[model samples]
Target: MNPIVLWFHKLGSPPYFDRFAARWAPWGHGLGLLLIAIGLYGALFRVPADYLQGDSFRILYIHVPSAWMSMAVFAAMAFYAAIALVWRIKLCEILAMACAPIGAAFTLITLATGSIWGKPTWGTWWDWDPRLTTELVLLFMYLGVMGLYHAIDDRRAAARAAGLLAIVGVVLLPVIRYSVVWWNSLHQGQTIRLFGESSMDASMMWPLAWTVLGTKFWFLGSLLVRARADNLRREAGKAWVAQAALPAVAADPRTEARP
Candidate 1:
């Protein structure tokens, strides 16, 4: 087998995954927080205020990253769901389920921040703008996946069912991405681009880059933590879980073996 494939096969083990998550999750969290702090500082103190929107536009630091993650995470969830449904990979199932809550959170933040930014720019807190409405529906899709996953008692069955929903709902992603282009939207067109020219100035773009990278790292950390917990839950009573839990039990004086 290819080294990469072999590594992934080893990673499928619950104990190996738990160790992997424990070893790397903190790095993701720490780096993510640090980058976000630097990004916010640059946004607040380093980057100049927008000529048109003034300081209110600073909210883009939070709003844009959250909005991007909202879609990105859902895409990831759907990808994992597809893998699980096709291959019956337990790790993929856990990861697909884990992505839901985090994606929903980012979606909520995007909506809230968008509303806050809109009040000043659009003179309204909410609008049925194509971009905004489809994003809201995206949130509902995340919630639906989560709700469906927990509604059933059988874990593997629930994951398969929810994964199916995730796969189906993925059709909404392209619609959300192109909504502003397809319809009359109160929302502005894309200003920042990874390729070609961006309408945003370089100074402003740097901090936004930091924020975007931060969110990705943060999501990585969150995914690992959530998946590890779910992995433990699903593997409860297994020999590996017992072995993994032994150290903690031994460390607790009350649970220690006594003569």
Candidate 2:
């Protein structure tokens, strides 16, 4: 077999994947922290305030990235769901399940920070604006996925059901992003263009970029950590799990290393 193919084949094993995840966690944390520190410094001190919004615009540093992650993680979840459904990959199912809460957390942050930003900008905390309302709906979608996953008893059944929900909910992702374009709304349009000149100053743009990158790495670290724990629980009775648990079991001689 090709070396790359062999490596991927081996990674499909839960124990192997768990070990990889553990090894990557520290590196993820280190890089994530470094990028976030730099991003925060630039966002807070180096960048000049907006002429109109002034310092209140600084909140965009957090709100923008969180909103991006909320959508990005959902898209990833839908991809994982497709893999689980098409190939019946257990790891993919676990990954899809693990992504739900993290996505939801980011969604909550987006909403909270947006509302806070709104108070100073829009003269109120809430509104029926198209983007905000759609974003609010996106939060409920994340919750629905989580709720459906937990409501089912069998792991396979739960994953399939929740995965389908996530795949279907993929439509909402674009809606949340383009709501401002599709309807007249109070929320501002996209300022940072990946391929073109951004509306933001270079100093502000760089920090937002760094913050977005930091959040991406953080999300991966969090997902792997959660998946590792889930893998352990689901595969507790396997030989690898027993061997992995042996140290703790030996330390406590009274306890069985049983699943």
Candidate 3:
């Protein structure tokens, strides 16, 4: 318990977090690029085409992973928000805010790719099915949190409000998770599960797994980058921000003055 508390304590410090984020950013970005390259290779060429869906099902390589990230990131953001609310931790709130835009991007990719996949498979670009509908709501919730954060002038107050909204809106996660079971839909059942036998072939499963891993790392990289930027924005008047920015500002002006 003491270790856990100390861990959170360290992460909650702005200077500590800024340094930690910078240290990990290079590794995160490098690994994300490597994983995406590997995943794409497996997804595009190594894996065989689906017998039923053919080339169109290949879209799942991107769509399914992006859809998974959308939900996974929100649930993660909500957990961070809960921590902030319970512990009154500013770092948690900043982390949650950082996650919102990336999660929204994944949600958008999910919708766009799903639409592309649907056109050839379902004969339409969009549907009001439960999965699709819930996904739309999920995107709105992300936007709402981000918008609310900026709406208030006071940063602390904005964080608290956004945290509250995130915690409450997490109720939608389970609904989105079980939507297929709760309602009739064109979308299929879950393919990946802990207890259930795998629904997909090994060839397909391997690529899909790689895709999921790539997407996860991509989010991690984006989260760190955005968190650093958010911290810089919030701490613009602080000594560290001034020190960090001044060097770059001076270097740029010198370069411009030279030319």
Alpha-carbon TM-score of each model against the true structure? 0.97, 0.94, 0.92
lDDT of 3: 0.86
Between prediction 1 and prediction 2, which has the larger TM-score? 1
Stretches > 4 Å off in candidate 1: 252-257
Residue lDDT tens for model 2, 1-259? 9999999889889989988998997777778778888898999999999999999999998999999999999999999999999999999999999999999999999999999999999999999999889888889989999999999899889999999999999999878888989999999998889999888777678898889999988898899988889889899889998888767778996876577
Candidate 1, clashing residue pairs? Answer: none
Residues 1-259 of candidate 3: C-alpha lDDT, one tens digit per residue: 6998898688777877888888887777778778777878888888888899997788888888898899999988989888888888778888888899999999999999988988988899999989999999999999999999999998878988987898899899899889999999998889876577878887687777777887887788889888888887878788887776666788784556543
In model 2, the worst 10-residue window by lDDT is 248-257
Query: All models: lDDT?
Result: 0.95, 0.91, 0.86
How does residue 185 of candidate 3 score in lDDT?
92
How many clashes (backbone atoms < 3 Å, residues ≥3 apart in a chain or on different chains) does model 2 have? 0
Query: For residues 19-132, what per-residue lDDT tens digits would candidate 1 score against the true structure?
Result: 999889999999999999999999999999999999999999999999999999998999999999989999999999999999999999999999999999999999999999
Candidate 3 pairs with clashing backbones: none
Give the CA lDDT, 0 to 100, for residue 129 in model 2. 96
